[model samples]
Target: MKKTGLTIAAALAGALLGSPALAQKTVLTVGMQSTDAGVLDPHLNSGTPGKAMLQWMFNGLVRIKPGELSPEFMEPDLAESWTSSTDSKEWTFKLRQGVQCHHGYGEFTSEDAVYSLARAASKETSAFSSDYAAFDKVEAPDKYTVKITLKQAIPSLLGIVMNYHGGNMVCKKAAEELGKEGFAKKPVGTGPFMFQEYVPQQYAKLVANPNYFRGKPKLTEILYRFIPSDSSRDLAFQSGEIDMMLGRQEQAWVDRMNALPGVKVVAMGPAEMSMLHLNMSQPPLDNLKVRQAIAYAVDRNAIWQFRGKNISRPAVSVVPSGYLGTDEKAPLYPFDLAKSKALLAEAGFPNGVTIKAINTTLPSMLSFTEATQALLKRAGITLEIQPVEHATFHQQIRQDLSQVVHFQAARFPIADVYLSQFFHSRAIVKTPTAVTNFSHCKVADAEIDAARSETDKAKQLALWKTAQEKIIKEVCAIPVNEMMQLWAYKDSLDLGYDLKASLNLGPPVLETTRFTK
Candidate 1:
């Protein structure tokens, strides 16, 4: 009997050694580009770093197909199936059974879905409340069915419900028990990973969910570390301390990282547009000619050169290029220093104008603002930059403290989402229903509103074009350039799919992600 048992144990040990899964690394360490996570609440957390961590721990009713970015590739996630009314104002979703929420919050059902959507629609609870302004109500008629009624038709209901922004679902029981402040630190969701721990200014750790509806994640754990310095993150990757990292968006950095042995650098699309919002409510900038002069002083090509051409492109309109309804023919102020000087002088600033601006200390943003500062200086405009922590910068700008705000963002790839949030009068900063209108711009409000509910595709596009023309003519903001997402990872990491683009602003680590060796 003893001899037989010994032989069985030896065979089992041999099998384990020969198995590919046993040889693969189970822990994935990633280096992000922020000092820390701002919040974990799916509806309120808007920062890219926070979104990257949240993507692993949450799921929407539906999700954009893995390895795809467009809404056309969306597939059912928590919801098994869904249907919409003929007018596209009412959507009904049938939830999948046995979907478990993290931290033993119990199964996710229609109740959780209804509660999540209502919370997301509340201005007091959600930063993206304006996105759901058209939402009338959400109801759960059964344990596994949810219905959403909207006040007006949007460009796409799927775009709002997919796993981005306010669409990510939260655990109903967990949220009620933890409350708002508590939930922000320890969010509960139905994704493949469960929140394990978060150390401020350091890292947020997650462990795989064994009961994930799809399947168990091959990665047993994920460590999302915050290394704000480029050199530090690069060194960590080289030393194998991190499996992946957010790469710096510059040609030199990309070339250097690609040259490293066993390292692969990737540049993905769905670029984020960087625009300079000259506050129309603030003096100096409030003057129309002054704003146009600032626009003329900005050289989009020079900005494109600063960031590599491969990862950056000149933005032709208020709406980003490649997005729906982008009008490439929208007028642009040429890079004419003499015109800029003449305009500045005409605005009664012969000795150069001084403008105060608050800037984020994030490396990429600081670099861009510094470039803009140099450009404006040549046109006899002195841009006084007050650099602050990323979070503080966002707060101060929203409080209407900055004369000029250099904001970069990517929203749903539609004209209405971009125009309504940035150029509409209702979204003006410091207001009760503020979204992100830092410029206090209302030039295109009429056109933007008309395009939102327009059924005719041709008329919708025409309205959007008119909106872009009006916004550009008013010089509310200077559309600088679009920057694509970039990252560096180990060649051995499979990532589970081909990653062309991601709306989460980072690589999505799914159940199949595993190291080859």
Candidate 2:
């Protein structure tokens, strides 16, 4: 089953369709905690798993680097050379040669880039939507050259391009000729794999892409099995039912996985930050004094005590440690019950404010939520806990717009991705129509705009710092602690866990992977 890196497509082709002596292609069954049961539309789907699946089945002009988190993907697949203006507001890309689209979609062209980006930017196509409201235009100068104009200079432009939702490239002719339904039904891409079938809630079946610019994949078929429960996924992994597991909630479970004779757990550093966010749209959270008090009240050490030593680290800023602009000097809101009570009284809630804290049914999150409840109780705040399914909770966060919720925000390689996703008004979580400001805070839109436009690294950092101060002072979202991501696989499998959300689960790394049989 071993295939050389340079000759992967040849090896797979020989194994799958060419060699008579070779057996059928090996199918890797990947187990995950959640399912892509709702929407296959890449733009509309909020889950990371869905984004990962789409990534394998499509190709973008630019991609994320395999193991790095700097927002630039080396070895351009579609676009060979990309240059950005000194100010970083404008960018242009030169497309590669001999790149053919799968499913009879035709060759790679600047039109495809324009069509794809425009589609993602369009409000009509929900699947291609993004927080890139600042994107002014995407134009095709020639068949192989594409130019992009942004409203502001953002250092994270490359990071945003490599974003899971934004990175997928679409066929211009197929997209226009077939429309949304046509494109969705039989999507085409110039990737290593081709979409064979999608059985909602079961699996997304894919075969090797023959017209893939690079070549065919080593594996004949990839079966992304959507296993809903952690217990089921763990049991399946233990029983040798699946080849790989995507993500695990608790370190103990991941440790247990490593102890198993056939499985090994892969731990990625600073994967996520789990926190209890207060809704600034509400009356109690609207008061900066009360928000500061809540930030001061929580004992992150005690909360992480449930997870044990080395499992989690206390977070001082909304952005985690690994990302840029995380200063050690940033004030850490140490636990102070006295301050919490005083601030609550100052906010006119002397008795305490009753609030609902919503969370998903993930086991580790349950423990984290309970710990938050206990901590808030010490501050004389009454918390009503509500647990929902992960998929449902993701949907609820988008729809109901609650006051308080148990949230786990992931850490990206770049600060811009982190800042833009949560802070920017253009992000998907915020309602596009409403000017209410989704974090429900009193942040100056003009400040966010300035941060988005500032290209100078130091100046951008300063702008982000200002915004962070405003967010913290207003108590937009409380930073809890940073957590790790764990994945278990057979030792025969050589899988690298990528720190950047855009890169880890994408095609470039997957293409380089070689599994021993």
| lDDT tens per residue, model 2, 90-167 | 899898878887778788798878877877776677533545667898888888898999887665565545535655
TM-score of each: 0.95, 0.86
As for candidate 2, its clashing pairs are 9-216, 43-127, 65-73, 120-128
Worst 10 residues of 1 by lDDT: 17-26
Q: Worst lDDT window (10 residues) for model 2?
A: 500-509
For each candidate, what is the lDDT? 0.90, 0.67
lDDT leader = 1
Counted clashes in each candidate structure: 0, 4
TM-score of 2: 0.86
Superposition TM-score, candidate 1 onto the true structure: 0.95
Across 338-457, the per-residue lDDT of candidate 1 in tens digits comes to 999999889998888999899988899889999999999999999999999887887899899999999988887888889998999989988988989999999888988888899899
Residue 436, model 1: Cα distance from true site in angstroms: 0.7
